[model samples]
Target chain A: MSTTSPSRWKTVRSETGRALTALVIALAVALVVILLTSADPGAAFQTLLTAPLSSNRTMGLWIDDVAKLTLTGLAFSLVFQARQFSMGVQGQVYMGGLFAALIAMSPIGATPLAIPVAMLAAMCAGAVYGFIPGYAKARFGASEIVSSLMLNYIAILVVNYLIRAHLAPAGTGQLMTAKFPDTAIFPAILPGTRFDLGIVIALVSALAVWFLLYRTSWGLKLRLVGHNPKFAEYAGIRSSFIMVSAMTVAGAFGGLLGSVFVQGRAFGNLAQNFDGNLAFEGILIAIVARSRPLAVPIVALAYGYLRQGAQLMGIRTDVPTEMISVVQAIIILLVASSFSLPGKKLFARLRGQKSANAATPEAAK
Target chain B: MIELLLTVFSATFFVTVVRTTTPLLFAALGGLISDLSGALNVALEGMMLIAALTAVIVSVYAPWYVAVLSGVAAGAMLGALMAFFHLRLKADIILVGFAVNILATGGTVFALSRATGGDKGTSINLPSKAVPGVDLSFLEAIPAVGPTLKSLLSGHSILSWLGVFMVFAVWYFLFRTPYGLWLRGVGEYPAAPEAAGIPVAKVRAWSLVASGALAGIGGAQLAMFNYIGFTRDMTAGRGFIALGAVLLGARHPVGAMLAALLFGIFEALAIVMPNLFNWIPGEMIQTIPFVVTVLALILFSYRAQRARQMRTLSKI
Candidate 1:
């Protein structure tokens, strides 16, 4: 506990080095895969890492991907921080997208008001969706993981049924919903690019989450509850309330992601494979970021780059884009393993101190 | 109405149920073994997917049995890898399971295209061999019950027969053997076994590998017999369903078998119903199995809760 400052720095450096080593190992495996399958491994690697940043348009796509991943990652981070494994973010997103599309298509309000209303509806829908599992777990002591996982399939199937039965536009047979009106569309920040105001919302949301989880008394209570519910209860904290609220907040974040994707990117339409596996990707990003709200955006950007790079690799070389999935799997394996290592306790202590110091700055002011 | 009922109970429906249940039964057994040992092998889905592809690809060159064995070996290797990471490297078991799943989802497709010369969806063009069905025509010579027995048991894959035997073998191993007790003790409370000088990690690791091998066999059944070829996402959530079955079966070997059979019945219906009821869409029909899984789980949970409540009431 009374180690020298240089020694502490060395410890931090070593942890970072271990993390980088894991990433390097993953990349090496990918490189071997590329070498085996493709004509040139070096060129494939170069294309994968650099091509996403090569042009404005490609950069914008990368940003768009990051925005979506950030939103989902933030959702997962919030829930995970409470020690709640809510795997139904995928389901919540489906409901969110559905509600957003419904709002966008309905002639209920003006365009300016309609967008926010749609977003709010989506958030509320997601919150309600999450509340069921949270309530079940809190009251009945049911396993949230099993419930959440089951609900995901139900949500997908329910959405699929709705899209095919009522929401589908004329001449559409692939179970896709009708496109929203032009007025419901999100305004793009970059011309001729997918980048939209969603990026700003995602960044602002991360900042808000960081503040909420650090500066507030409730945040401290939540953390205490997450770490040890019995101790938190003894400390006079309402653990159930925190659990429900945390889950609702997590769900709202998931809803926001889906709504933003629908309004900004997909133009308020839902496809059969509308999920795009973003929820899973978000889980990976959250794990990689160690469930830190602030770190989500950074990790999400890296994920976005990797995804874009994988696509580029697929295009330029014989390497299939699915290699990205393999890389993600390897990274999770490495990261989860790293976290369980003996040195991670020291790393957590350091992180705890850093977060505590960071929390005090706004409090002092 | 009688004709419709007859059609529902026909040989085709029977075969469909058998085909659907074979893989699910194997996977359920896999899940039960690991779970009983206190290691929930969530990677069953991923293992099955990879094995299905492996079997399909390998069958192009080797015999169907060899292909199936290759798939099982692949799953065993993955299980060993999981054990290495989780037991030795100290990784989270769930995370390791998910990593395997993610790898399977992506790796299978990548390898599939390479194997099939860039086809991503189906391995129809590949000369993959089918699992040889058991010739039970000899049963017909056994008198009156012979034809009935042949209809019930005949034309099933060789792997299906192995599945039946493995169930009994697994049950025997768990109930009678010293290793089974050690595995169960490790799962229920690792500290007790650790105190007794039994290597807790080693038991869990072997359980995971065994689970993976069982799941791999299930995958081979799916590719070689169920559909006769591999398709992208052909398991379609059966692995997860098998996980549910593991619980619904009360985490016992026999219970898993019954649960698998029940789900197989629903899946068989789903497959057969679309053809019979022209009014119902194929997608809706296909969703029956998943829907039934949720309903069955809910009922199971409700009953468990009720049983607990009753016990408390009796105590009071």
Candidate 2:
């Protein structure tokens, strides 16, 4: 047990080092781009790195984002651990939010049971959405990447259609549902801020996922299938069942994010185009955490801080907020890459050729 | 009903189909080449977005063709970058492609905002040039069916004609050439080619480069002709739809074009439908192509699985 603990610590340390290296490199690249574009690079950089801490309200927003990212990160991490790339988190989020709103706006929302019912509805919606791609992949051998992305577009459009047609009031001229009932909403947990019970949900979900992955037999089977499907099958594990269940569970987490977002302090009503690629950002968080359940919130906190900082920076400085995505892309590429590059190989090859030529000259001498 | 039928069957509709299909066909052909070489080229979307932005920005100062070429170069460079990460650095191809996409989505907007002096959404402030349409008015000189022939044959962007030629060229290169055979062999069984002294990695890398270049032209066509400017997220999943086209076309260049044309027709219908059917929600109509893509892919997967089952049974 002691031996295993030391090795695990080593792995954690190494992962953290690698993540830091990627972050530093990504930030350096962002700085260069900022210098090229901004007339006041100093101010932009300072704002990007520091502004999220400037006020309590900003800190509240940052913490709120942390909660959302933690949930999304878990959603991606669950399927990643099973070696499946669902990418349906975005669609699932939409479906979850739509169902949550449907429940939250109904007469049941006025009752004390409103929150749990809405949450369950959202999870079911997200699970159903997630299940479609998993079923398609398991039974028909369809590509999950393509199917999930296609479903994402369909879900967003469907949600938009439903809201515009059925939910929006007749003369409001807005594409949002009526404000959700106060009882159905998550009340603020902190004074002077919108931060609420969602953070607790995010933390509890992360803990539950960690327990499921490390303390449960199913997690072992899922990991076995991920490591070697043929061997897993030989060992009598049903790989297809695990794959579908892994995706479905991951999708439940994604669906939960929907209810959290809708019922959270961020927005009291369901609005069109509210996600703004938040689902995609979860993939980045998952990568940064290396798909480890316990590491997800830690990574989410760091990444969410940067995201919130960038949001504030966009308002205050000449730099655009989209700069964060560039940094995100660089971080992902660097984190996924091995340290050895082709440049080193080419350099070594050229040196070898030079040494060989020198040896021939010496022989001639 | 008569008016709708008249519009659908007219030469103008055919022209619209060709115009819309040109970009999809180019991207689909690109997707086919890379897929044949064992690279999925998911970065096609990002590459196209960057290329479209590049083409528009370049057109502000340079000639139209030069702007298009710049777009192609940008895409090819991105492809080379993807290849470096996937092949040399041992990164996952899908992840690398996604990274490129994220970069393109955010980076293009960043660059566009700088280029347009604070307009992050579009390049409207820039006086970008458009690809001149190929006017085949000379066909109007012919007596019989002159006007109809002119309408059918004229006023397409020059790139649309190139897109037609490229379908045949890609088909020939993928089937009729030794290099094409080598690329196919590499994709099918890399070990066999590697044993025969083929540079499998280099072939894949070059395929990715060529794929990116083709996607770049598609982007140029989109920015310069289809819409005549760059808009945020303007590609609007066309790159993804092109991937579907590649599968629906059964991995063949000719088939890819036909599949692209099929989608192009659906997209054209979406554009034309709002005016005729005002009662229908525009969002629902917009989803038709994506819905069709999902259904088509599901059907294709089912058929392919059955075919495999039949082959195994016959062997037994």
Model 1: per-residue lDDT, tens digit, A200-312? Answer: 98999899888878888777877777777899999999998898888888888888887887888535576665867877788787777777787789889877888988887
Model 2, position B245, has a per-residue lDDT of: 84
The runs of at least 3 residues in candidate 2 whose Cα sits more than 4 Å from the true structure, single-residue gaps closed, are A1-3, A340-365, B1-4, B143-145
Best by lDDT: 2
**What is the per-residue lDDT of model 2 for residues A1-365, given as tens digits with 9 covering 90 to 100?**
12498767876776788789889988999899889888899999999999989988998999999999999999988888888878889889999999999899999999888899999999999988889988988888777777888888999999988888888887788899888999999988887686788889999999999888778989889877877789999999989999899899988888999999888878877888768788888878887787878889999999999999899888999998988889999888877766433365578687775422221110000
Alpha carbon lDDT at B85, candidate 1: 85
Off by over 4 Å in 1: A1-18, A139-141, A172-175, A215-218, A233-244, A266-268, A339-365, B1-8, B309-316
Q: Which candidate number maximizes TM-score?
A: 2
Docking class of 2: medium
- What is the Cα-based lDDT of residue B126 in candidate 2? 92
Kindly report which residue pairs in candidate 2 clash with one another: none
User: Candidates' lDDT values, in order?
Assistant: 0.82, 0.87
Worst 10 residues of 2 chain A by lDDT: A356-365
Question: What TM-score against the true chain A does chain A of each candidate get?
Answer: 0.87, 0.92
